[model samples]
Target: MPKSRSRHGAKPEVSPGRATLAAACASLVGIGLARFAYAPLLPAIIGAHWFAPSAAAYLGAANLVGYLAGALLTRPMASRLPAPALLRGFMLLASIAFFACSVPVSLVWFFVWRLLSGIAGGGLMVLAAPTVLPWIPQSRRGVASGVIFAGIGIGIAASGTIVPLLLQQNLALAWDGLGLLALVLTAVAWRGWPARSAPAPTLAARAKIPAHSPLPTTRLRALYVQYALNAAGLVPHMLFLVDYVARGLGQGLDSGAQYWVLFGLGAIIGPVLTGHLADRTGFGPALRLAFFIQAGAVILPALGTGTAGLILSSLVMGAFTPGIVPLVLGRVHELLAHHPSAQKQAWSTATTAFALLQAGGAYGLTYLLTATGGDYRLLFVIGACAFALGLGIDLVVGVSLSRRRFA
Candidate 1:
């Protein structure tokens, strides 16, 4: 591990735990509330006639597009903005975006706000690492990062549980309630995110690539494809799992919502469990495990959304949804470590590549789902195929990539 020291002379007042907590809250807003909240809101969003059912996917796509843009700009933005300022600013923007959804805005306006909210979510994901990582002691970084990232699951659990209940009262109130909740959380963490005076960390800058570093282009590209496949595979479940339970299984919407809640509960502990599994079995084995489990989870619902099958599927799928990324990134680091230089660039490149895949996949699948007259079952099947291919890639290319050396 690199020597732990504060950059740009950060103050001692803010404990590392506080900073990690702030990152967790930011993750809640940036991703949990801003992005994933939409899934629960989907049926209501369509029911209220905010947009046509056919256009629901496009609204979701807009957020992913903005997320890609924000990720691309993350490195540059971190350098320019203080970690706290950026965190607060983007968080406030995200909160406003949530509030804006409650109003009867035109479809175009809703799309615009969704895009803005996506940007906030992306910024939070990119910034949270640099903001929290450097502040913590070396020995605790792993655990702290896990806690911070768990904010996504926390937010998901909150949304799945709360949003359904809120929808019973009024859909607009649900949006308003979420926005208010974000504001309250932001206020609590406001002091902890590092200020302008503190050291503002940069992801690409921290690892510092050597000029003569060899490009492990093949391994890197393979990693990218694998990451993309993993993401593309999960979209159907992430976006429409609740609806699937209700419509596909002939269960009611409330039953579908309950499954979403179960998924969120699984998500909350997934990162910790995933990290432990990777430690014992290795990231490769872990990736393979996650892929297979996720595949089965997606496919089970399709084969038969029986009560037991749905519950089991929900647990496994939810656990691995947020759980897979850390393992993938860990694999990326292991591959780049041997190179000695360009590791940081490789990290940035690999994540950027994955983000693009997510964005592109969102757009493509939205179009596909709409074109097929909202054939969600077909989408899940396609997702399962994607997961199957990812498993194959890991068994073949992933194993080889781990063994090969770059000169």
Candidate 2:
């Protein structure tokens, strides 16, 4: 029997399976290798006199700014170029730019390279849903997005394990090696990715949504606010968690590193599990659960005085926080349907907002920490409040959406 028609009276068709999976995996590789590898390696790089403390922070901020620009540009670029070609180009640029970190250049040059890498990484993220979403059955989008995001966990784990060991022997060599690895992975991805036609119907159909569709506009705005707030809450932990463990809790470098590794481990598992749960329960409830878990996790350290408390807090926060990105994006996919143009707009807008929010979070933490005399406890308090606020907002949005459906 023929498949039932969609709301628009078009026969539903399943997208090709292998090709879609390959593309999604490639996107994961690109994001994992490019965006995440830096954090794991930053300590070693800073210790080696490669970047002064202020310079390193500036470079990180620059990367965030570049990401915002890239997210804003992704849709316009996709409109003109083939998605595959654009993906290949962005991957290559990011790979090369990251490898440039090994050259021991001036700090100015380092910031430039990092900024370019950030831009490329942003493009890859914004492009991922549009490039891969069409190939996924609507019913399976949550799982597919989870699977794709799981690559981030793998990438984080790989960097944590490999970079530290390499930097132990030689920092420059490790940076160079990481770059080479990214290049090879990009090549592998390019080879495996399927060819796509220009001006595809999926793309065109997505672009046709009326400007007044409450679904896309409201959902996109909600996601942006949620993500931004979440990112703000997370930045303190991402940047200062190690310092808190090492200085605040009196842990050694190795112990701090292990803590990060545990965090990465949780990150690896968080998305897949959250995605599965979202599929069964709905994104709204899943996100609320995640935020509450994160809120509790961040506050644990503040409540405790010993190593056990800190370690437990680290693991819990790590597990819940990073996974939120995929969950939020997956929800966008669910709300917008599988249309290409709408996907592009939704992703681009959300990502851009996310990037800006990340930047704001970083800067906000910086100022707050400096004002508080480098006291992270106060930051944790702020983060906990922010997470609770985000959870409340998400619940409200979910309830509002449900009421609209019945009305």
Q: Whose TM-score is greatest here?
A: 1
Residues forming the 10-long window of minimal summed lDDT in candidate 1: 1-10
RMSD of each: 4.3, 4.5
Q: Per-residue lDDT for 102-140 in model 1, tens only? A: 886688888999999988888877776655666665345
Task: Give the TM-score comparing model 2 with the true structure, all chains together.
Answer: 0.85
* lDDT score, candidate 1: 0.75
lDDT of each: 0.75, 0.70
Q: Kindly provide the TM-score of model 1 when superposed on the true structure, using C-alpha atoms.
A: 0.87
Sliding window of 10 residues with minimal summed lDDT for model 2: 5-14
List the candidate 1 regions with Cα displacement exceeding 4 Å.
1-13, 137-139, 195-216, 338-345, 398-407
lDDT leader: 1
| lDDT of model number 2 | 0.70
